[model samples]
Target: MNTPAHLLMGAAVFGRPAQTKILLAAFFGAVLPDLSLYVMAGTSLLILGISPQRVFNELYFSDAWQTVFAIDNSFILWGILCLVAIWWRRPWAVALTGAALLHLCLDFPLHHDDGRPHFWPMSNWVFESPVSYWDSAQGANWVAPIELVMALACGVVLLVRRVPIWAVPLTLVLMAAEIWIVRQWLFFFTNS
Candidate 1:
């Protein structure tokens, strides 16, 4: 699933606390796994003085980098973080970690052969589901439109529930941006 879908689903599932901090934590948690891309790109730009195009070209296309980032974003690490949060009695941390786990759960079934190593560090295992959320060649052409509809519905739910004024619109915009980027830039660059 896309980040916005994960965020909205997390919020819908765990929004009962109705606390701003908790909601924000959930939002961040949904996106935390994907931060490896930003971290790598930022480091490449700042530390190595690499151009953005080269960074994207290398990192997004390299199998080794993909494996490394997959391990970095694995479920085992997030699960351990959640366990630690519970042990430390940090409610917000627990909420954040729980939402991250939820994101992984959603992703587990949506990825194709190039799936995350969800059990990395413990084991280099990937589920490699037949369906992919973004790859049209991997039976995801139908999923994109359905996911957009679901995201819109989630946005309406958030608006009706009186979530922060910016939440729904921001979610929608982010969702649209992700769809656009995947369809226009990422697919074109990677596939061609």
Candidate 2:
């Protein structure tokens, strides 16, 4: 998934919020998985920034990215964040973890090359199908199915919780918009 998809997932989980720190924590938690890639591409940069490649690599092992951040790490991190948030962020932890977990769940359909880490530490497994972008469909991978799910799930929960009924319609619209956005981003609008 791309950054927009991540933002969409995070937004769906934690909508326009009334809280700040919780929002930051959740936002960071949701993005933590991608940070692994930065670590990978960035081991060198960090070596430059911090001036120590061996120490940086030793502090955060390369395989850790392959295992922890590669697959389901965001969900796991969100779980820990949720528990930790309770001590600091209270009920907001619910929203925070929701966004973070949703980030991973959203990545499910778009996982590139079937190289998804669903079980994380349990297995460096990758799930791919012709239906998914991971199989490298004809430029169809840009569409973020997770956004649709997130919007739908958020709508359902909002309805059940009696959140503003207006949210349902709005979310449905968002889903459609997301599909088009993904298609455009993956194929048309983006520089291929």
Candidate 3:
């Protein structure tokens, strides 16, 4: 899935009670982690390559540094962060965490296909995705197709669930477009 998918999923998850403000917040939070992938940061894709994803993973979620954290799985860190965020009463905590979690879950399916490290330390377990290696331009197998389908499904569910009618079209469009954009970036530029 792309950033838009993350945003949309986050919106769908956090938009409960259906507030436009929450939906908007989750959308931004979903893509916030990608700042690490920008080249001017001196730590973007040009410098770190695909490991850019890893850096983002660790920047906010991975508990790789703590003796007691043992964050082999990102969810634990997210859960902990949620607690922290809630304690601080951060309005964006749930939305941000939802976006981040969606990003990780989407990556899980893709990681299996690309042989990327999903288990980190637990052992190489493919979630059985046929993605078979990550690329920026040409996503492995039918990633674009799959992403499109899922994005559409999410849109329909969101709409049927009575998400504001006006919001539906833009979210739907953004989700589809973002998938294509990320697919291109991950496969095409990464190779360059």
Candidate 4:
């Protein structure tokens, strides 16, 4: 799933009492895994003065970079965070970690050969599903529409729950925009 979809799901699951901090934590949790890409891209841009597209090309094709950043999306990190939450008895941390885990769970069945190293640190294993969230050739063309509907449904739930009036619309717009951007990026990456 894309970041906005993950954020919407996190909000639907954890956004309650309309507390800003809690919602923010949930958003961050959903976004944390993808931060590895941001960090790698940002550093490459700064140090190498490369265009964003070039940086993306390198990251997408580089096995070494994938291995290095894979830890960010690993179940090992989730487990460690859960253990920390348990040890500290921090409900907020637990909620954040749970949101991240939800992100991982949603991603698990949607990735093909380029699946995440979900069991990293303990083992280098990736459960390559036949369907991919972004790859149309891998059956994501059908799945994409379903995900959009699910995200819209989640937005409705947020609205019904009386979340900030702008939240639902903003989430929907961001999801749509992200979907467009990612598809374009994928097209360029694949055809270039």
Candidate 5:
């Protein structure tokens, strides 16, 4: 799933209208899994001046990068943290780790060739689902639109739950971004 979709889903699932801290925690947890990718890829594209093809095709699937992905995308680690948070009776912590776990859960079945080692230390196995959210050849033409709709529905859920006024325009902006991203995936990626 796109990062924006994850953010909206996290906010809807774990965020509270008045609890800024919890909402922020949910947002952080949602993005944390993808943060390393952004940082590494951004540095490669901008600072290191790497071509998009090499950066995504080669570096993205490298052992070192996959290792980092394993730790962040690990269901075991996030599940442990979630349990610890629940034991400690920390709602914010629970929301944080719980949302992260949720992110991994959602990502698990949506990824095809790009699947991560979600089980990690317990197992190095990567479950390559039959569908992918971004890969056109992997049913993304249907999957991506459904993802966009679900993400927008999550935004509506946030609104119905009486989220802050700022969330209204934020949702709109995110919707726009998701649309643009989908268009890019459908057109640019499919053509390539």
Candidate 6:
């Protein structure tokens, strides 16, 4: 799933309209899993002058990078945090961990070759699902559309709940970004 979709889903699931802190936590948790990827890839591409092919194809799967991914995408760690938050009776923490867990759960099956070791410390195993959100060879043609629809549905959920008026434009922009990315991927697949 795209990061923007995760953000929308997280907000819809764990955020309360009037609670800015909880909403921010939801957004942070949603993006946390993918944050490392962005930072690492961005640095490599921008600072190191690396080619996109090398940055994505080679560095992305490097052991060091995968190890970092394992920790962030770890189900055990997030579950422990969630439990701790519940025990401590911290609503914001609960929202954060819950959003993170939701992000991992949604990402669990949508990844094919690029699957992360979600079950981290417990195991370094990555589940390569039959469907990928972006890979055309792995049913992304159908899967991506469903994902987009779900993301939009999540947006509706947020709107219906009456989030701030400012959020409407942000949500629209995110949806548009998702649409553009999916279209780009589909075009690349068809052209290739």
lDDT over C-alpha atoms for residue 164 of model 3:
65
Q: How do all the candidates rank in terms of TM-score, highest first?
A: 6, 5, 4, 1, 3, 2
Clashing residue pairs in candidate 6 (N, C-alpha, C atoms within 3 angstroms): none
After superposition, the stretches of candidate 5 with alpha carbons farther than 4 Å from their true spots are: none
Give the runs in model 3 whose Cα sits over 4 Å from its true position.
Answer: 39-76, 85-92, 112-139, 161-166, 176-192
Deviation in Å, model 5, residue 106 alpha carbon: 1.0
lDDT of 5 by residue, 1-192 (tens): 999899889888988643778877887898888999999999999999999999989999999999999999999999999999999988888888988988998999999999899998899899999999999899999999999999989888877877677777776787778888988888887835
What's the true lDDT of residue 154 in model 3?
68
Clashing pairs in 1: none
lDDT score for residue 105 of model 3: 67
Query: Candidate 2: lDDT over CA atoms?
Result: 0.54
Model 4, 72-131: lDDT tens digits are 788888879968986997766766787788888899899887677888888777788998
Q: Ranking by lDDT, best first?
A: 5, 6, 4, 1, 3, 2
- Per-residue lDDT tens digits for candidate 2, residues 1-192, read 654446445754675452455445445655666676666557655555544555345534456545645554544545666678666756556666667677777666565453446565555666664444322353444344544455446544434543344444544565566566656655553434
* Per-prediction backbone clash count: 0, 2, 11, 0, 0, 0
lDDT of each: 0.73, 0.54, 0.57, 0.75, 0.88, 0.88
Candidate 6 total steric clashes = 0
**Pairwise lDDT winner, candidates 2 and 6:** 6
Question: Which 10 consecutive positions of candidate 1 have the poorest summed lDDT?
Answer: 183-192
Error of 3 at 109 (Å): 3.4
TM-scores of all candidate predictions against the true structure: 0.75, 0.54, 0.56, 0.80, 0.94, 0.95
Worst 10 residues of 6 by lDDT: 183-192
Better by TM-score, candidate 3 or 2: 3
Candidate 1 displacement at residue 113 in angstroms: 3.5
How accurate locally is residue 97 in candidate 3, as Cα lDDT from 0 to 100? 66
